[model samples]
Target: GAGVSQSPSNKVTEKGKDVELRCDPISGHTALYWYRQSLGQGLEFLIYFQGNSAPDKSGLPSDRFSAERTGGSVSTLTIQRTQQEDSAVYLCASSLGTSGGQETQYFGPGTRLLVL
Candidate 1:
């Protein structure tokens, strides 16, 4: 019904801690994606889920990062043993479909994580 929503808009954790970021996509959207943006760097794709098909997890930087979408709606990104370098703004986006040309991904405000 509404745009994507992310909980705990900001987070601060000590190094070696684990964190879980949540995302809720718009109703009826079938494609969802997660990305990370460091202080001044471009958005780095983390994962993608489209309908009932397999999710694309190739963009995850390491084994510590993982995500899953449930019932084609809410999704969560988890980072285990977080390092300082893992600090960034985690973003979630969703689109109606991805089969056509120029599918625009509408992004949420994002959850800013800081690992001390």
Candidate 2:
């Protein structure tokens, strides 16, 4: 992919449904990250993976949220039993592989999820 691509730019679900959002990161990049941005909040870091290895899980909100990256490229975020409080924008970013050498991340357009 040229840049990061996310599916279903917008999603609306009821209070107790499951939703899966997809992301296809730029080819060859290895550092992938997930973040959540609410209506009036800063981007909250969720998880970060470096080539299939998730070294950070410090931000997942609850047991209902989970994600994974495979082959160091595509990733998916799944929310189970969604709630109104979960309504927000889910963003994905990828970099040219992360280590002590990497500096920044490239962002995707984001998936707007509305839990009603």
Candidate 3:
């Protein structure tokens, strides 16, 4: 795809289960980000990866959430021991590496996760 694409447009999982969501950024985009939007909430930043530099994980809501970008292209977000509060639409975004934290990002359609 020419834009960022996320796998498993929808997911339903039992509580305490683990789930993995995948994202593929546009070719050559060096910066990637993960965000989630819960009901009635705006996008919440989760993680960011830029090139081979250390990923910025400051936005993660809990220790159960983690993400990684490999080969500067694909990214995976894992949620362990999922809770009902973890249900949300996970969104991925990517941008050119030129502008540091100010670069414009293109977003994916998002993976809707439902924890029951």
lDDT of 3 by residue, 1-116 (tens): 58899999999999999999999998989999999999999999999998999999999999999998778789999999999999999999999987986788999999999999
Q: Please give each candidate's TM-score.
A: 0.95, 0.93, 0.96
* Model with the higher lDDT, candidate 1 or 3: 3
- Clash count, candidate 2: 0
Clashing pairs in 3: none
For candidate 1, report its TM-score.
Answer: 0.95
Clashing pairs in 2: none
Best by TM-score: 3
Looking at model 3, which ten-residue stretch has the lowest summed lDDT?
96-105
Candidate that beats the other on lDDT, 2 or 3, i.e. the better one? 3
Sort every candidate by TM-score, greatest first. 3, 1, 2
Indicate the worst ten consecutive residues by lDDT in candidate 1.
95-104
**What TM-score would candidate 3 get against the native?**
0.96
| Clash count, one per candidate | 0, 0, 0
- Which digits, one per residue and each the tens of the lDDT, describe model 1 over residues 29-80? 8999999999999999999999988999999999999998888899999999
